[model samples]
Target: MFSSHSKLYRHASPGVQEELLALTSRLRSVITAQGVVRRTTAAIERSQWLAPAEWSALQLEAMRALALHAGRRVPYYREMFARLGIDPRRWRSLDDLTEIPVLTKDEVIAAGERLLAEGGPWLRFKGSTSGTTGRAMAGWRDRASIAFEQAFVERQARWAGYRRGERRAWLRGDPVVPSRQADGTLWRMNRAENMLMLSSYHLTPQNGAGYIEALEKFDPVMIQAYPSSVGYLARWLEEHDRNYRGKSLRGIVTSSETLGEAERRIIARRFGCPVFDWYGAFERVAAIGTCEHGHYHVMEDYGRVEFETNGDGTANLIATGFGNRVMPFLRYRADDRVVLADPGFACPCGRSFRVVERVLGRVDDAIRTPDGRHVVMLDWIFSGLFGLVEAQVVQERLDEVCIRIVAGPEFGHREEQALLLRARDRLGAQVIVRIERVAQIARTRNGKFRQIVSRLSGSNETDV
Candidate 1:
């Protein structure tokens, strides 16, 4: 279980703050000593060396068990199977799963009450999405599912060379400090997690040095943050002719936002450490993490992922989670696009799991064509072109889009025509695509760079 400082601590006196910190540290130590961490570590050690066939067998067995439980215990799935004329008990292999219909976020939002099992041995908690796609939805997760998710995260941390109980710093969306507090401490100590929770909203140019100083004093062995948050600091240091290298940092782990090649290089150079990118969603349907060799490998045991080919060499990801039996997500559509690599491709890290070529942003990042098609990854329009430092695609309306670019010396009319032609070819001839050259693209309030911003607000009716 996770622990947080009480609200009373916010109003406590200076002496009480220290006392609270001490109490938090003690609580964290107790939680760490519990069997959760130990079991997770053991699972990671065993699964990493499993042969390909052995891993597949284990996953299939888990899938069959989950399907049986859902059909027997869960109200929604039991009724769904009956309505679709499917018998979960008769399912012999993974291929038989196609008889069931896919689940969507809209269905989860509309019929969540029917999704939960009547009673179980596990405890349940309510969780909400970040609403980055403009639609916020809530779901439930059982304690066992939560523990397993934490284990997978711990396994990823180990891949990044971080050990449990080591000091670390976090720069994410958590509001550790009040946004209005302009002059005081911008961070709080989560002594239980041994974490220095830094505020992502306070990373301004004037406060960059203060943040750097605090991190240096804390001497955290690893920093887990959003790519945009760390990228901002890296840019600030470069502009000021300063550096934060030669510290206690072992590696930097990034998530939440897409990490670009340029931003990765900048962060690695300034921090003197490798940057590992992790991709996952709150729905817990699928997860992909960067390996030591910088290739993304799907955690095959965590979830089952199926790709829906889009004929453009990209596919939408549909996943079924092995965890979270409280709200079983069967053939859930994630709406995220990815390019899958050959199944025979093997990582030098000796893992036999499948690899993903790239995660092309989310479906919400797509521009809608007049014929009702969503054109995703329009940023590729500027790919391989010189003199383009950064680009953003804004879909303000159904028929029009604005391409914002931060161009360098070599950018010219020829490059502009190329971008326009590429967009037009994907969006069709009637759509109006315009290019707007700018000094720099803007980031979100949480310091995230969104490649595609769609102003349209409505339900996503795309088929899985």
Candidate 2:
């Protein structure tokens, strides 16, 4: 019933392992609540008294729990805590978190071997991420850590109008293709719900039509996808004067990448459904997400986020996963930046989670010029090029950039020329700009399509 090439067997065979994982997940989904209301009520309760002070307190408590567990079981953390003169019991606040040094991608890569060698108590499994600067790193996640992740995921789904067993389509980091059985019959696994996996990488005009048709056929109550992919589809529909009026879609969920206001508005206008933007990273699992009222709300009660500055006002994001245990990421630099929203902006929806005005782009997405100058305002270039359905900018060298665009037939050459000229005009005369026409652009393994790719190395600093 399974294909020999399928990786579903890595953990266990297709039939048994898939069933067990689904059963366990379903149990977990209901373990906290009989339905979405009960689960959402708990979250609402947590957010009600969730002042900044409470956020600090929870982060400290979470760190203490992690340190205690690590001191007893994980070798690296045990030695590190000992060297820092920290008693697992004495560590009790966010200030104590300051005492613990920050964890970086490089440290994670090096400690991997030690983690594997010890093997018995440590959770050592490979988890890949395109690090803060688009560099790939494969790290380990413990079983305890994974459970914490599952909880956050379930919570997010509930927040966005999803029930435990509700039918929904997940357009995530993986490809959206048909799964087939040994007899070549389309293999469909129904886990008390409906989920159609769509590949974000292949969001071509043709494939997009198929996607729209699939959404209608599956009749999922929700559609979830990366901001770029959703925005691309929105732009396509808008350019063609088409409507993706999927009758069953309650809304569209955009996550993993920064979703600009323009893209959000366009998506909502074309899709005829609400667009919810989620801000999260692989390291922290859950951070901030948009509510129905279209504001980015912080999950402060669940975790803590800190900005590590370079003294000149530039900062790197460091997040502590308050809920995870198997691999509690303590003060791990996320490499994403944000501008904290003022406390006064409250949505009428009454969700207690505070909102952020916007999430700035990733640190790795920035471009540096040859004369030691930096291009900080990415939105400026993006806003300047308005007519594009899809676009990407790759900086191959200090003075060279390759701009790729997938413009509709209605999009005249003059508009495309203007986009190239505007990008070149933004970078000035010294930078060589090459505009290339592409049928498709590449995305990361997790399906994040970066609008800008910077290969210009050596200048690693980013100002938030």
For each candidate in the order shown, give its overall lDDT on alpha carbons. 0.73, 0.60
Q: What's the TM for model 2?
A: 0.65
Q: Pick the candidate with the highest TM-score.
A: 1
Q: Model 1: per-residue lDDT, tens digit, 65-149?
A: 8888888888888888778888766776677888878888778767767888778854467766522332335678865776777
lDDT of 1: 0.73
Supply candidate 2's per-residue lDDT for 253.
83
Q: Which lDDT tens digits does candidate 2 get at residues 131-202?
A: 333333454555444555555556666667777667787665441222221112112233544565554434
Provide the clashing-pair count of each candidate structure: 0, 4
Candidate 1: segments with Cα more than 4 A from true spot: 1-37, 130-132, 363-464
Which of the numbered candidates is closest to the native, going by highest lDDT?
1
